[model samples]
Target chain A: MDLSSINWLLLIAALMVGATPILLAAIGELVVERSGVLNLGVEGMMITGAICGFAVAVKTGSPALGFLGGALGGAVLSLVFGLLTQVFLSNQVATGLALTLFGLGLSALMGQSYVGIRPPATPKLDLGPLSDIPVLGPILFRHDPMIYISILIVALVWAVLFRTRAGLILRATGESAEAAHALGYRVIRIRLLAIACGGALAGLGGAYLSLVRVPQWTEGMTAGAGWIALALVVFASWRPWRVLIGAYLFGGLTVLQLNLQAAGMKMPVEYLSMSPYIITILVLVLISSGRGRISTSAPAALGRTFHAST
Target chain B: MLIRHLLAGAAMALTATGALAQDDGEPLKVGFVYVGPIGDGGWTYEHEQARLALVEEYGDRIETVYQESVPEGADAERVLTQMALSGTDLIFTTSFGYMDPTINVAQKFPDVNFEHATGYKRADNVATYSSRFYEGRAVIGHIAGKMTETNKIGYIASFPIPEVIRGINAAYIAASEANPDVEFNIVWAYTWFDPAKEADAAQALIEQGADVILQHTDSTAPLAAAEQAGGVVGFGQASDMAEYKPSPRVSSIIDNWAPYYIERVGAALDGTWESKDTWGGIDTGMVEIGEMTDAIPEDVRQEAQDLADSISSGEYHPFTGPLNYADGTEWLAEGETADDETLLGMDFYVEGIDAEIPN
Candidate 1:
């Protein structure tokens, strides 16, 4: 209720911690979707990553290596999806769904011995001097390294998608595979690589949850963050900067609701908890409610399977 | 120290390995069928703890076996059958979801003794056992009522099952008893093993000024939430959550499966097995109270101990009479006590509770 007492700085810091998971997952999805492949299995990849990260971190006693293992574990599983969708020419949605169900079952089995045991504690970034500042100290100077890396990824993705010639080719392939193929681009190969990157990023997101945030390997740890990430990809209209905007918005909703409750607001906590999902749905509806043919910069061959015609 | 006891037990396990060839008169094989991973911080952890206690207590007398993360449907029956056929003299089906399968497995292997957790369907060879977890909730409700500065409490319920619903009512009753102005706000994650959602739910509760958070779902997320938000208090369900001590977790309702494990299977081992439905709480030793940490004020601490003593001494029944439905209609007669049968199949929420129970 008192503006003078409201710590906007801590609030921003909370926003970053909360947004990191989705950022990792969504950025990966952006690459995957930008390559003309739709991965409905992001949820599965994330869970598998969570378990693999936890197991590796617990075994190795290094959170950094655990994150690396998580990315590889996710990318490796996504390779299966890449093969089936790109080479095997299987239906993307069905295979992706199966990936989720299988991941759920597998993680449950693998995490059996790990209950109640705490993993090695993650170290927070100690911005020694800057963190000691009065107003700006905690916000910019304090965070897990994962938060910094995720934001860095947004910048890298933006540069790659908009500036690089390779980014142009990838975007061209997503827009029209036949055209890109005619120009001698390895369309399937490019798409597979993009999908793998997305998986690895999403894997990192899942790992951040187990290794740092909640810091426990829980079954169904991702909950619906993957779905929210999926909605975010569209909300951003598949642009990198927009992904950051969308991610932080959802993250803000998450943090703000908690802050509201902390400030003693009488809103039904249930409804406030459900706000992020509700707002995402509304955003999607607004995005989809436009004029004739929903005119926009959508990838030309999005969600369509391609086969090499003899 | 508990940690040393665990380590010493691990050491004893190595020595017990040599007696593998002795074959002490048709070896007593023990099989554990888990509903979730052994690593989860809630229900399965407690069950696994009991399994370890068995290993510590019996040493080489018991041969323990386990199949982790088996679901509670046809898979449970399959696992139970495999264990029974493999000479498992006793099988512990440790989930209420496994009740039907437990009963089914009991009928198939009449010689095997099955002890199920938190359910009441029993056969001649099958027996049921559970803690009056709701009773512990009442004691915390008293603490929560006095401890809460905002008069709002958050309850993260796993499922709308009778066991979890009963906990909600008990917590509400205690909270209201402590402060007539108290209110309960709930969020159903509808899952037994999700930390992210649990954290999100706890955050929502903490944001809304719920200084006390209670959970029926298994995990340390609520305690983690309490750590993030100062002044928030919580309890460890099914196990003593030692991870968060001193401040957030003041007391806990620890599951004591050792006695029941000894009682039910000891008879079956001695050839006196029979079917029975059992529910034991504070009055019995099935549920033991964890030590009160320093977070609790002295007055609240003494009051909590007194309530725990009354329950353990059989001088108190949490769900006593002069109770009313949510609509203010009388459910329990004045001065009337609810017997085990009525309490076992509890269906209505007494007055002062706000959440709806799914049919």
Candidate 2:
């Protein structure tokens, strides 16, 4: 692998595009986790979004509306998760797993007719001469809208989580639902909204995959991207900016491994193919070894069903 | 436990119905298990097409059932068992990964006929069948050698299985035969049908200056990637991806299973079916080379067509040698051709390839 042979700018550009989907999904998941909810159905929601987005784009010839369709589809599916866990007080983990399975099957069935059909192209943002600035031009300015939106979403999420009164109350609910309930905050409503937001973002991630990345709809197209997002949230320690860095790192590794293979690196292909996941797990392990400090970062009431008693 | 009891009850019911059907002269029940969705437009799509052809040929005499996107391990065993219990007389397990499950299920249902695709395992009731896809690969490799400007050909291999290995060797051999300076860059996606991964692999290859891409994985993503990269060329694998014709997709390797499917089903109906391995190639019309689009120069296109014709006429062998392993070990002497045994268990990369075959 000659260093000179690699195009650093193009690699970074590919990294950003690769990271966008995971970053979007992870940020949404971070919000959901912050609101004391663990929705493991990110994969399910994303795939549902992929097919719904692809179907709408193909039907309406509008990639923008297709993104809306994707978000709506994901939010709707999250509503089912919200209903099952919040209304019926079911175990969040099992319910999330069921949701994933349900979403996969539903998407496959919905996508049957949409398969082999191409969706209208999602256009890139035009920055004119600014986009032509040598090394930074292609890396920063020449990406589809969702790539920029994903980073903006991260910034917005970081600000909202730390700087707003609503953020305080949401954190309070996550820290102690009974305390938030005593303070008269609608904990269930807040958690439900967070879950919906998470679903919508995950859906957008899925949409980015179908409309721009692979740019086609095939059954089970998400291909475990949702699970990767879920992992990213945990690795990011529930922080928005960390999630951005983690997603890029993971995405960069993915792209780099492929580049290495293309460069005819003598290492085993399986090792290179699996390096991204292995590295992610290692980072997670290192962070988790921080023990109480790391454990304290997770929402206290996460994955627990909230029940109001007399 | 609930599913088990339910399956048992269903099996009992199916047994009674099957006996009555025999008395009532009912149609033959055929079941298909696919590794990917039927709309994949490649490997699984071709199998589904063959299933449809079976229906069209037999009409009311045959009734078909299929479970799409079935995974290939314990889940496959469960699905195969369910089909067997449901009184499916002939089952086509269409994937290399379904070998063990097919064999295990065939053992339980001794009377039923089982045909597994691209697998080596077989039993008294199970038969293995696959197209000689390497034959098609050879023609495309020749085209790639001639068409490539960079003299670097990228291959997106699925798994390190013998079937895929054979294709890599065949393509590399033919490309080198045409252009001695042609170099191969291979990336294993480790999947049969993930479009996203396949696309990413193609992009990496294109970025590394490969102008011609070949894929053993089933998806149009590679061709789409090649199209996006503009000057890059590619060939459709397993099915004719003619949609991108005249550009990135200059040609394709089509798996034509209809005739084989029709003949096998006919044999089952005639009670003449027995366990056997079938590796049909271009000569048998099982593996076809799709149309060479105008993207290829007229002379080169003719050369590709001629190569296909020679393979079809059994006048040429893609694996003929004096060939050697990548490690410089002699594989075949002068005028020697690879036998079915060597091809079936191919594990080494032929000379000129630089990558290791992942275990």
Candidate 3:
């Protein structure tokens, strides 16, 4: 296949669009992981945010506040996870699963009238003359602001993780809650805040999905992007920049297949559709096999419950 | 054997559950398995609407129970079996994905009547039902043909499944008829009920200058995306998205399940239930026209309504004769309605489309 046949610009643009859903989700997951917690309910939280963002936007007709509402909605819901795992000291996995189940049921119940009704639209940012350039124009400059924000969040997360003392403390907590606790760090509070942050980011991702990306709320609307985001945190090996690359890689796969189909390539269309998901699973399995001392980058207590008595 | 015994045990447990729910004697029980949430405003929503209608019509005579957003897989089979085990005399598995599970479960409960939606499979105990969604597609495709300035139309497709594909082809046919120059851009979200993805797909389609957007998915997101595009417009799928007034939503095609649902359940309770393949369309009130919005011009709306009425009145058959396959070979002759067998087993794209069907 000639590379020329591929709309690299459109491919890249689609990749960016695809990444916004994952970027928003993975960043939230990263924070939750950084705090020595794993919230498998990213999809649930995102869908909840999707419905909330969708409902609020349709009700209020403001996309900006709609995103904020999504973030808040996600954060608030994630707090239930925080409270369950942190305060009540429940099994994190079980709690996360329940969080997803509860989120699905609650969102469905809430999304009844919101179904089929389009929420208020967010305007695409146009750089005018700059958007007219070949290749580069559509690729880089012409997406909704949330696209740029996702990339910014990645960089900001990187800066926080590698450059800041607070980042070190959070990392330490993820590595060993007991050690971090010994250092006078409030492990529970740190994890709680991290989860809340992750929740809000996930909510933003979901909001971006409903308000900007898809811009409508339907039941179970996140469509496994949240799961992809969870997988991305692992794919990125907990590194923020890697999340960017990983997110875009999978996102590109998603975009490329569709573009190929749209360009009218004579390939088994089902294979094209399944390619992204299959490739991700293979890449993930490959990565997990070679990475043994994953805790180097991984916080020690990721997915493990912390007990003060211990 | 394990499943049979389990189903038998489930029947016993269902008796207990039913006994618990009723605490009194009842002759009949009904349940619904929804693939999407009742609130999704598409297929599941339509099914739920029918369930509500059944409730309204039958009142307390028929005890209906429903579980929403059930996934289509082993879980689906389990849920269907449970509904039957729960002593539901009639069960409606409302999704194309539920076909196999419906059949699988129906085989176990020979006495129980099962109606599987949008599938070809059937058993003595099971029946198949679907709408001529393609017929609806033709009218909207015609409208999109008339309305689009870019000569480009976007279709938000749910899956590559035949049911959805047929609608895409039908829309293409009607669109091409209205304006021979119109080309379609399809965005397959590969989901049955993810509104966020559906909306994103719609947005991308609109960004590509598709002035008219259509959807095979069951959310209002496409119409919403069309609205958000500042000037782009679209049609409603499965439900009347009349909420988006003034612009974006021009008209809608509603899939009505109430009349059929009322009939089937009534039959079941009266001991007249039998399994058969049913493909209902405009004539049966199974597919109804939505409120014609002001967005459509007077003449155009009149023309669409006329075509709809003709179809309902049996004056037209959407898959009329003189058609060609994607390979440019003739499939049907002019003025000959494609036999039910051909339309039911449709696997090829019709003439005048650039899309290639993948095996």
Best by lDDT: 2
Better of 1 and 3 by DockQ: 3
Model 1 lDDT, full chain set:
0.80
- Model 3: per-residue lDDT, tens digit, B63-158? 999998788889999998888988888888887788888888888999888898888899998888888877787788778898888898878776
Candidate 2 local distance difference test against the native: 0.89
Chain A only TM-scores, each candidate in turn: 0.93, 0.96, 0.92
Per-model lDDT: 0.80, 0.89, 0.80
lDDT of 3 at B237: 83
For model 1 the TM-score comes to 0.77
Candidate 1, A1-310: lDDT as tens digits: 3233235676777777788888889999999899888998888888888888989999999999999988988899899999999998899989988887777777777777765556787788887898898777788787878888898999999899889999999999899999899989999999999989998998898888888777676677777777788888887878888889889888877766655544445455567657767866766676567744423656878888987772
Interface RMSD of 1: 5.0
Total backbone clashes of candidate 3, pairs 3 or more residues apart or in separate chains: 11
Candidate 2, CAPRI quality class derived from DockQ: medium
Q: Which digits, one per residue and each the tens of the lDDT, describe model 3 over residues A3-60?
A: 3445467667867877787888898799789889999889888888887887888888
Pitting candidate 1 against candidate 3, the one with the higher TM-score is 3
For model 1, the superposed segments whose C-alpha errors exceed 4 Å read A1-20, A38-41, A48-159, A162-164, A175-182, A187-189, A227-310, B1-24, B59-61, B85-87, B354-359
What residue pairs clash in candidate 2, if any at all?
none
The DockQ values of the predictions, listed in order, are 0.24, 0.56, 0.37
